[model samples]
Target: MRIALGVEYDGSEYCGWQSQPSGGSVQDALEAALSKIACSDVRVTTAGRTDTGVHASYQVLHFDTQAQRPMNAWVRGVNALLPDSIAALWALQTTDDFHARYCASERCYLYLLLNHPVRPGLYHGKIGWFHQALDVERMRVAAQMLLGEHDFSAFRAAECQAKSPVRNLTRLEITRQGDIIAFELRANGFLHHMVRNIVGCLIYVGKGKYPPEWMRKLLEGRKRSDAAPTFSAAGLYLAGITYDPKWKLPHFVEPPLAALLPRMSRPGQSGCNMKIR
Candidate 1:
């Protein structure tokens, strides 16, 4: 049977999502725990691979297992052997044709930036930080320029192996409350470090280093060198994966991004749970 699962992980300690021979990747740890549960070696495929220090609130993956164990074994049982940083949120049996990566209709990412005169204390690895005050409106304006289909070569990482830089970015929303700024992006697909690189360019515009119109120029340039440096991976989160309802994915949690908004200030911060879809 093919089983699909929703995962939550703190990627701070691992190298990335792909399985590595050294066994440090999130995939390696998950496969290890899963193999123990199945009593055989197991391999899995993910919707997307997050880089090191990048987190995921609802990462999706699918694996074929002949071991006829109950669903809880795949969820709670595997979690028991796994490290504290990784968790299995929900699991459901899926059709053999369903693919965690290819079946995905869209992927969403969330980035948190703490803008203040001093560095972040509690949110060190959880968020990106900048010392200078950023102009949120300017960043918002610059972010709008990134919406829709475009050859995002300017924002893509040099090592990105994706065959095409063209992506249909459906959403790029930026919101701010207090010193914390939230960026929510949804796309048909993403190039490596694409979101972080765009965030870096937005910050440049926010800090008055360039006008909002410069974003269009960068997009037109198609040269990675002309764009701003890639932002930190610490702030990045694989927030959600969207699949067709025909696949019947289980409900994740009470609300989206709940696992990630922990570092928010109280009296509470508004707009932290920005819509992903």
Candidate 2:
């Protein structure tokens, strides 16, 4: 039988999502806990593999198990043995054809950054920080140039294992409240370090290091070194994953991304909404 599970985790302490031989990765901790419940070796497949210091509000995975414990055992029971930073949110029986990675049609990521004169103390590892007054308008203008299908090699990490650099970006939205700036992005797919690199370039534009038009130039150049450095992984979140209705997953309807969104709202706010879809 196959079981689909939704997971949430704070990735600050773990090495990353994939299982590591050293046994410190999030996958290592999860599989150990789940195997105890199944009474057999348990290996799971995830919708996305997040990097160290990245977080996940909604992540999906599937594993095959001959053990016939109730769904609650997979959720509550496995969670009891798992580390406090990781928890299984829900579990459901699904078709064998369903896959956590391939079935996912879209992926959403969020980045929360603190822009102020002083470095962040409270959100040290939970959010990114920059010590300068950023021009949100300029960042918005630069972000728009990233929408639609394009070769994102300019933002690709050198160690990325992806076969292609071309990806369709469906949405890119930036909003701000006080010193907190939020970037919400959705895409059919993302290369390694793509989102963080994009954020870094936007920051460069916002800080007057480059003009908004420089974004289009970088995209066309398709040279990773020509673009801005990759931003910190601390603020990155694997917020949502969408699949077709046939999968019958909860996210088949509306994804639960809204739950992870930053709700920092203020009226007549100069640091406000700038979205491209």
Candidate 3:
């Protein structure tokens, strides 16, 4: 049978999502617990591969297993065996044609930044920090240029193995509240470090280092060297994935941090917090 699972993880402790020869990967840990439960080797495939120090609120994966255990065994039982930083949130028996990666129609990511003079103490490694003041309106305006289909080679990493640099970015929304800024993006697909690179350029515009129109120029340049440096991975989150209606997957998976922030408020208001959707 084919089993699909919703995973949430703190990528801070692992070497990224994929398994490596050195063995400190989320996949390695999950497969170990799954192998123990199945009493045999079991391989799994994911919707997307995240980089080191990145986090995921909702990650989907599937494995072909003949163990025939209860659904709870794959969820609660596997979570019990996994470390505190990793978990299998839900499990379901899926159709033979369902694939975690190819079946995804779109992927969403959220990047959080603490734009304050003081560095974060309590939320370190959970958010990106910028000491200088930033103009959210400028950043928002700059981000809109990235919408629609484009050759995004300027934002892609050098080591990215994707066959093409073209991608259709559907959304790029920026909002701020009390020194906290959230960048939410949705796309048909993303190249390696694409989001981070875009964020870096946006930061430059936000800080008055560049005009909002520069974003379009960089996109047209199509050279990685023309863009700003990649932003920190700590603030990035694989927010969720959208699949065909036939799969019946949840629309919002709710990152752990989302629960801790306030639901509504204006920027600079006292005790204001925002959730990236």
lDDT for model 3, please.
0.88
Worst 10 residues of 2 by lDDT: 268-277
Q: Which stretches of candidate 1 lie above 4 Å from their native place?
A: 251-255, 258-260, 263-277
RMSD of 2: 3.5
Q: How are the candidates ranked when ordered by lDDT, highest leading?
A: 1, 3, 2
lDDT digits (tens) for residues 117-195 of candidate 2: 6775655777788888799999999999999999999999999999999999999988877767889889999999999
- Give one clash count per candidate, in the order shown: 0, 0, 0
Best by TM-score: 3
User: Could you tell me which residue pairs clash in candidate 1?
Assistant: none
Task: Please report, in order, the local distance difference test score of every candidate based on alpha carbons.
Answer: 0.88, 0.87, 0.88
Per-model RMSD to reference: 2.4, 3.5, 2.3
Instruction: For residues 85-182, write the lDDT of model 3, one tens digit per residue.
Output: 89888998999899999999999998888888877776777788888989999999999999999999999999999999999999999877777788
Error of 3 at 71 (Å): 0.4
Candidate 1's TM-score reads: 0.94
Worst 10 residues of 1 by lDDT: 268-277
Clashing pairs in 3: none
Global lDDT of model 2: 0.87
By TM-score, the better pick of 2 and 3 is 3
